[model samples]
Target: MSNSSKAVVSFIVGAAVGVAVGYFLNSDKKDELVEKLKDQKNRLKEKWNKRKDQLQDELENEFA
Candidate 1:
């Protein structure tokens, strides 16, 4: 009922859904799929880092 509890529940639900999707998507070509997923994960991480840096710069500009 509390905000923290709601957030935790949401995270658990989302993780479960993600796991189910991944499991269903896996196949005989697991090696290829794994490589593709690794590349996608790296790309996502790069994008996230860039966004984080940009947000930090913006916050500094606004607050400093």
Candidate 2:
């Protein structure tokens, strides 16, 4: 597609995302949603840290 077409598509997608985020932020359940997102964030961080540690240990063993 042309550059102009791509730009238009990107703009539309961005606007849609902005609207959705605005709706969620304005909703009554916003606090609940935020709490759930925070919990999910924590879970992902823990998982990532665990995986990183495992990889580090494997690399150390390989080098040793």
Candidate 3:
């Protein structure tokens, strides 16, 4: 209903999907898959953080 609630729900859903994908990939490739996923996760975090920071800056500027 609220913005925070929607954000929380989105985070939970994203986490669930990530875990499921990791589990399946790990089952097939074991160590290699785990390493690949770790790299992907790090990249995803960096990209997401950059985008989020940019959006926040834009919003702050707009409001200021």
Candidate 4:
């Protein structure tokens, strides 16, 4: 497999391990974990939207 494929497999394995560990370790704090994850997802989405808009503007400027 290519380097990128290997990287993707490694990431998937790591994420699985992380989720399993988190689930086992925080059996009593599920609600808190869910809230934190939701907040993090919202922040990441906002950042991605801003970055996408910036890139779109740059592309339009370059071609206009």
Best by TM-score: 2
Clashing pairs in 2: none
What lDDT tens digits, residue by residue, belong to model 3 across residues 10-63?
999999999988887668667787798899999999999999999999999999
Off-target runs (Cα >4 Å) in candidate 1 are 1-28
Choose 1 or 4, whichever is better by TM-score. Answer: 4
By lDDT, is 1 or 4 better? 4
- Compute the lDDT of residue 21 as modeled in candidate 1: 71
Deviation (Å) of 40 in candidate 2: 1.2
* Clash pairs, model 1 backbone: none
lDDT per residue, candidate 4, 1-64, as tens digits? Answer: 9999999999999999999988856898777777899999999999999999999999999999
Q: What C-alpha lDDT values do all the predictions have?
A: 0.92, 0.99, 0.93, 0.94
Q: For every model shown, what is its TM-score relative to the native structure?
A: 0.56, 0.86, 0.55, 0.60
- The C-alpha RMSD in Å for every predicted model, in order, reads 7.5, 1.2, 10.3, 6.6
Which 10 successive residues of model 1 have the least lDDT summed?
21-30
Worst 10 residues of 2 by lDDT: 21-30
lDDT by residue (tens digit), candidate 2, 1-64 = 9999999999999999999999999999899999999999999999999999999999999999
